[model samples]
Target chain A: MSEIIRLTTPLKDEDIVKLKVGDNVLISGVIYTARDAAHKRMIEALEKGEPLPFDVKGQIIYYVGPSPARPGRSIGAAGPTTSYRMNPYAPKLIALGLKGMIGKGKMSDEVKEYCQKYKAIYFGAVGGAGALLAERIKSAEVIAYEDLGPEAVRKLVVEDFPAIVVYDTHGGDLEEMGKLQYRE
Target chain B: MRVVDVSEITEAVAKLCIDANYNLPEDVYEALKRALDEEKSPVGKSVLKMIIENADLAREGVAPICQDCGLGVVFIEIGQDVHLVGGSLKEAIFEGVRRGYREGYLRKSTCHPFTRANVGDNTPPVIHYDIVPGDKIRIVVAPKGGGSENMSMVTMLKPADGLQGVIETVVKRVDEAGGNPCPPIIVGVGVGGTFERSAFLAKKALLRHVGKPNPDMELAKIEKIMLERINKLGIGPMGWGGTVTALAVHFEMEPVHIASLPVAININCHAARHKEIVI
Candidate 1:
């Protein structure tokens, strides 16, 4: 195992370019959350020339719809959702200078291509390890699309939020590489 | 004859909903524990470790095992000698689901399929009922997440296609699923039934204990073979690749028409959550 890279939100191109597939990352600072419904609305807003819920530049979007938080909790059993559903909207956001995404599962070839062209990265977290992952998130607040319920866009303050770079700007794909290494 | 109050059914459903989501079943937990040792990839091993840890944390009841608390799927086996009183059986199960999500802090995942409006309170559970020869009712609550449910399929094959075709179809389904359904999955295969019955059988197969074979010797052999073939796909934990893509392959079957050999594959993610109660 190599050293774990530490990063904060509003990530820079230079910061992303240095990363590669299979690199472990500890992301600290603010990350935004959005899933199926929120993504649809965001795409619609952009088509109509309205501003996004937040500035997309340099930020990472986590694909998740977390369970409700109980009393005295910042968030509830939070973890990554499958990322492929966001494929339809991710390329546009990547073009708008979004630097990274954190989720589980494979991305479409088009999404990977945009990541390469835009110098962004795709990270994968343990998909069902929600309770364990929740401990790393210090706070969460809904910033947009509250009508969407769990799919509402949330602005989260996280610390050492762990993930692995599955797709890097250099055309490295960990999902492809890792499978080949173990496929018997 | 024994009388069962609808209120009792409602309360039991509510508790089972919370229990299923907040706790990982022992069979699934044990499967993951074994996979950790057998997984070849470092990343796969670590992912398995974290999943195990998450189950441990979820048991404390602060949160569910996963964020997608899933659409409540309840199975009921009512005894023939029992009389249900006080209310509608369907309404009782739905009420249980609502109360469970509300009181347990689980995510309400049901919604309008086309309009995409949130149901707000995870109600109208998908209920399956069976009549048995007893005085008790067996209730099982299995909260199935969207990720894995999307990966499920029902296929109809020629009678000539036989067992080999079924095995190939199941293996292909898992291979195509890649990592999307959450690897280290449990595959439930239903064969030898009509289209809808096959689908139901596949889903019901998932309620069985992980890694346990069918009591029928022939079906057990097929399950063991399919499990080996699926794990060889190397989708690993969460699909990043490893030696253990699936923990088990559970098979269930029923008699079919002479011309049809319908098969259904229902995939369950690593966070397989189901609980049962007898009352």
Candidate 2:
């Protein structure tokens, strides 16, 4: 197995290009959270020339809607949601210099094209491993659309949050690569 | 006739909802362990390991297994000789769901289809009722996640399509879904009956133990064949790609009108959770 890569948020162009599909990554520092509802709102804000909840440049957005945190814990069962639901707005976000996205499932062709062209990367979290994944989140607070409840946009501090580089700037795809390697 | 209080029903439903979401069913937990042992890719094995560990943590912490705690799906088998009292059965079930989501810290995922507004308390569960011969009530709560539910479908094929058509359609559905539904998924297929009944069967089939064959020999054989074909797709664990894309393919068939051959496929993520109780 190849050595795992460690990264911090607000990823640089160098960080993205050095990665390949199937590479294990441990991402620390700050990452933003959003899902279908928040994504739509973010794009609408962009279209109206309104400021976004957070600056898009050099940031990572995790596609997750975590359960309500218990009394003392920072979060609860926080796993990545399926990524395809964000297809409509992903390209727009990528073009705006969003450096990384964390979610499960495949990206659309257009999303992938934007990732390659704009130097962004797509990372896959172990889908459905919510409770275990929640352990890595140091803190979380809703930054925008708090009324959206679980679908609200949150800013999170994560440490060694596990992910796999599913799509990279060089047009690599782990889903296809892994299949080719193991398919009967 | 045996008298059953609606309060008992409500309490049981509430507990089942919380239990199903917080604890992974033993059958599914074991299947993940077996998948971990058998998966070839290093990443796939790791993914499986994490899923197994997540279940353990959720149970120990008394937290939700997945944030998408799912719209509460209640399957009730009511005995013909039992008398229900104290309240409306449907209302009781909804109350149970509301209390469970609030008390259990489960996500309230139900919403207005077009408005996208959440129902807030996860009320008005998707309930299915069956009348049975005994004088008892059997309640099963299966929280249905949106990700996997989105990947499910129902189709009406001509009689000429037969078994081959069903298998091909199911395989194609999973292939197209890829990792969207979450790999190492349990595929529940409901064939024959009318369109809606087939869809109902598809969802109901998921309540079966993971990978256990249908009692009917013919369907069991078909399930084995379809499972073999699906895993060959190499969707692997969480679609990271490997040999264990699906842990099981469960097929349930019923008689249908000669003119219709309806089939529905309901995919459940590896969390494949459902808990039951009897009263």
Chain A only: TM-score per candidate: 0.99, 0.98
Local distance difference test, per candidate? 0.92, 0.92
CAPRI-style quality class for the chain A–B interface of candidate 2: high
**Residues A1-184, model 2: lDDT tens digits:** 5688999988999988999888899999999999999999999999999999999899999999999887789898899999999999999999999999999999898988888999999999988888998999999988999988899999999999999999998898888888888787
lDDT of 1 at B192: 59
Top DockQ prediction, candidate number? 1
**Which 10-residue window of candidate 2 chain B scores lowest in summed lDDT?**
B60-69
Quote the positional error of residue A56 for candidate 1 in Å.
0.6
Candidate 1's docking class is high
lDDT digits (tens) for residues A3-97 of candidate 1:
89999888988899999898989999999999989999999999999999999999999999999998999899788998999999999999999
